[model samples]
Target: MKKRTVADRGADGSERPRHCADGMPNTTMEVHVMHKSIRTPHADTRRRAAGGELIGSQEANGTHAWRGIRYAQAPTGPLRWRAPQPASAWDGVFHALAHGPMAPQYAGLLAPVPAKLYGRIVGDEDCLSLNIFAPAWASDAVPAGVQRRPVMVWIHGGGNAVGTAASYDAARNYAAHDGMVVVTVNYRLGVLGWFRHPALHEADSGTAEERSGNFGTLDLIAALRWVRDNIAAFGGDPGCVTIFGESAGGQNVLTLLASPLAAGLFQRAIAQSPVAETFSVHEATERNDLPLESQRTSAREVVARLWTAAGKAPDVDAADQALHATPATDLATWLRSLKPEELLSVFKPGSVGICLSPRPVRDGVVLPLDPLPEVFRHGAWNRVPVIIGSNRDEYRTFLADKPEHVRLLFGKLPLLRDRAEYITESNFYSQAWRSLHVEEPADAMLAGGHADVWTYRFDWDEAPAVPFVRPDILLGAAHGMEMAFAFRDTAGELDIFGINTSSNRAGRRAVAQAMGDAWTSFARVGVPRLSGDAQWQRRTHGMAAETLLIDSPAGGGLRMAGVRQDIASLKASLRLSPQVSSGESRCRIYARVFLWSPLFAGLGSEQEYAELGREFGCAQPASVFRQLTEV
Candidate 1:
């Protein structure tokens, strides 16, 4: 095998070295397209003439690129809540010049703001799209043995509400420098994608699949299916695909790993700050306003009272019926009204009593079983390799947004500016402890196969860009900060999730260099290497798991300095009495239900069911039985 640079062409035909009349090099380049058009069934799409590139294939100059490709169709209008269907082929060449739109944004989740104001576009309905960057010259002519490359698919994170694949540009940075292909994908977000109603099943009763309501999630499945079927055309090994994402995206990745629908679509997976827990079907029905025995009851009630003045339960299938006629705008307003309360309703409700509690639902058709339970009981995609970890200050970001909420809890505010103090003042000490429980799912997934599990914490925080005290208040590498370095867009301004150090060129380069190498190496093979030459250690059982910490000093290998036993204790206490509050109840139920279902199935442990009982405020045996049977 011959070593290649980003610009070099090997067996793949090379483009002619051309210059303008004035002999100036071209700043813009054309990306190649792979067609599944019936007219060109076995078509060859070499971009030698225009520099079209395929994903995951190595090229000369060590640069690789894959332009626009279809992962899933936009699920708008009649398609809303429907499973994604394969996209149709085109006749003339289609240019994947820019990213497609993001999912519809509501008040919470992925609500996109102005790019100028926030550096990100708000969510839209037409967000289904795909983009890839690979070695610039990877071509069909590249021999088969030399073309064996690992593939990485990225799912953007925005709390499962906001964010798009278009938010980041991996083409110029990670793909070019790492010598591997990178793919970014978009999926449905917020109510437009996740809303559920019982009418879905009866309206389309011929198909049992019509009942489940995880549209955004199924969009991911469609994307993976596209990669499995079409990635090979771009010199990618369909068998070597890896799915990775952050936050909600991370949650989605793990959900797919556990979902049977996603089995065998990819060989490895990574989830950052994963939302490992989801609502049981019963919980979803309750939150979505469905009656304990019927979704139609609640949906009809809302439609009749809210949408129709007559307040009548018209036929469910009637297009103008109250149940089906509720507008998307109205739905978004309803969801937004519930946003602020989510913090209290779901995770860490402090003073507030009740809050909005919309979460992922475990419908038997889509989710099958709860992810945590599935993982704990050795029930997910057992054969794939995985890398799972969380940011150092995952929850503090939430704190930064609501200082008053903290003041409401702790009485007087603590004057803390240093990263350490902030972590303490923000109640991070308690939060981080409970968070360690997240490792159960990853551990179970790795235990069943030849899996390499790597964990990490990002500690770097750039100097504050604006006029704010604690210029570097230092959330200590808060959630999603690592994304800037990973995608190598530290210099480029983005719509939202802006560049961390927008002005510092050298620091961005170094971090980007390190991150790109690590990610691409993992995609190429199974292990991730931090730098071009540095060897990353594979994680093993019964050892202090080595984590590559991205901090002021760019280095790998760091462990949590503080003890996590406090969190364990807190978790245990919460399990015994989850109904103390909504946040406590939600977190405790999520942890126990997810923990037992995945790794210790049929354990019938008292702690697990006891936690569930507490979540529903089941004061008596009859109430507990009622809740379980109703679900």
Candidate 2:
């Protein structure tokens, strides 16, 4: 196969050449090009780092960006399903212009493509690369008495299934305005990233790390190792590195906290809208038999599906028998021989190309055998300065897409079908998300003796109230809304729905500035100091724990609030809340909170659901609960 170079094409797969407007090779050491006009430049875009000699580009923000720098070799062919290996040093200048291919996944919002390719499988297996954004002075000679800037590594979220580093421009505001070094990484996703079966393990002679069924987690550790070794070349302090991510990325942040291999790799951690859930080795490898186990796609299920599809068996039972009879080595080779698309086809796709697959396995090697909250409670995790938070209306973004709750006007804009139902469901699920992802973890960390833990609740929901769209009700402080504020994304890179309108720009900018300052301040020092008299406090134990409420000035601005509710309290309140009009409605909410949401797996039981229903004088039938359980 031919080698890929940055000059070959753009991320959209269009062929483009790297050159200056003067029709000459743009190989100057330190040339600044502003609005297509060259100007005086003091820093060299070229750097000799641990990876190799490479040439980056000077961005409009006065930040230098090095794109598509390989941190690990391609996890393809024989290297598939194995721990990442470091990339070998190259000989000549590498054109770090465009981003490398993302991990193979169905096209969606996380990895957007043209409409014609919306749900099609895109990207490649050779996708273990990272992008760097540093202040202009980073690549230049160090000043006489200046200290190295703090490093912040960002991990994108796509359910650990579909996301790319290229979608984000780290230099836009974080690296440029905050005076910090930023790095974004791409790792394997979906089944390719996390899968475990006895056959593959029997065929391999590798160590525990390779057989952990947590290849994506290992990829992140590899990226951190690369940062530790090479970040200093970009004038960043490796010792002050911070890892921050949202959603699935946030879950990864929590996973790293529990991972013994990740100890000392980072000094500070931030997990935004993270799910504090990790699967057991049995959950990752076998089919779900118990009611507590999540109905996620498992290794055995995938093999059976593939077997039936290939005419090797007529049904899942037959497929399982055939798979059991086959030799382990032969099974391993057959699995590796399948194409990426063929392997991905076995699982059903969600509304936007999301595949509900198992990931971040608790293999007892990379991660502790206990659950993340339990790990924290036992004081066994990497106890670092941590900042954890969640959006106030996280579930609205997800529920807005469901036809039962919302309907699209002209098949484009969203209109809530039942306002009361929508609000009630959104409130319950959103708070449930916070309980699992934010509150429980914070409380557990405090129990585990980690004192420097700051918590926040993003309450900014100033989206414009345009015609045919009820932004306030539909997407008020929804999941991922806080990301733009954190990154100060004035370019609207994340505003896919046009939420950041002209009318809301001022309020958005204000919130963004506040959030950006707090984030960078946390990265610099352990404490997150806000502007003026408003102080962000660390979370303490019990009900009086303080939480910083992040919002626009019109929405109360940034201030400290008391502790929030947990899952048990939320459940108890729901049973008494006037919003639940009927037993069926209450049962539906219970099913979604306990069964449908992956974060709440093993936290609910059928008996509990039945008991809750009995409180309403009409318990839902067993069939109704069973159908929801399967979902």
Q: Which candidate tops lDDT? A: 2
lDDT of 2: 0.79
Best by TM-score: 2
> What's the CA RMSD of model 1 in angstroms?
11.8
> By summed lDDT, which 10 consecutive residues of candidate 2 come out lowest?
18-27
Stretches of candidate 1 off by over 4 Å are: 1-68, 107-123, 138-148, 287-359, 380-382, 405-422, 425-430, 433-437, 446-451, 462-468, 490-510, 531-541, 545-548, 554-566, 570-631
The lDDT values for all models are: 0.50, 0.79
Candidate 2 per-residue C-alpha lDDT over 1-631 given as tens digits, one digit per residue, 9 for 90 to 100: 1111132345877533221111111222221222433423233777777768887887876678888899999998888888999899998888787788999988877785776787899889999999988767644563211356677899988888888887777334666676678899998998999888788888987679877889999999999989888877776677677899998899999999999999878878899999888888887888755543346477887898899988999997789888989998999899899889998887665545677776888999998989899999994788778999999998777777777677787887778887787889889989988988898888899998777789999999888776666788788889888988898775676675568788788888888778888888788765677877888888887647489999988899988888488778888977888988777788888877776566565567778888977877655564454322221
Extract clashing residue pairs from model 2.
Answer: none
TM-score of 1: 0.66
Positional deviation of 377 in candidate 1, in angstroms? 3.4
